[model samples]
Target: MNKIIFFAQTRELVGVDKLELAVDQMAISQLLEQLSLRGNKWSLALKEKTVLCAVNQTLVNYDYIIQEDDEIAFFPPVTGG
Candidate 1:
């Protein structure tokens, strides 16, 4: 399983901050597709805003490999403070 963390608005939208999904070899798009199946709010949240994804503390490309026990985070684009 991989560790997935939702931050800021993502967490609120999902109604959970973290989850362990049984996916180890999927691309970033596949991961979002699975999550989007949750319900209307989740799909809407993604569609209505720019969601940023990070894998293992690094900003990643769409083809980035997801491995077992990896840390993934999803959140809206952040602005400089």
Candidate 2:
């Protein structure tokens, strides 16, 4: 199982602070697909055209491999100067 966190608007959309899922060794994209199936909240939340993901506080691309108990967070893109 791994611990996943969704931040900002993503957190509000999911309606939960965190989630724990038992999954085989999988990539971040696989994780997202699994999460999108969790329920209406997740499904609706990810309907946006784009969303950003990070692993353990470090920004990562979709291909990142996750291991047991890893912390992943999904959030919308940010822009600042």
lDDT of each: 0.81, 0.78
TM-scores for every candidate against the unseen true structure: 0.88, 0.80
List where candidate 2 sits over 4 angstroms from the true fold. 47-49, 79-81
lDDT of 1 by residue, 26-71 (tens): 9887878788899977775555337788899887765677998889
In the range 1-81, model 2's lDDT, one tens digit per residue, is 777888788889889878777654788788778788989889777653467887778988888888777788788887668
Residue 30 lDDT (model 2): 81
The segments of candidate 1 whose C-alpha lies over 4 angstroms from its true place after superposition are none
Give the backbone clash total of model 1. Answer: 0
Clashing pairs in 1: none
Looking at model 2, report the run of 10 residues with the lowest lDDT sum.
Answer: 43-52
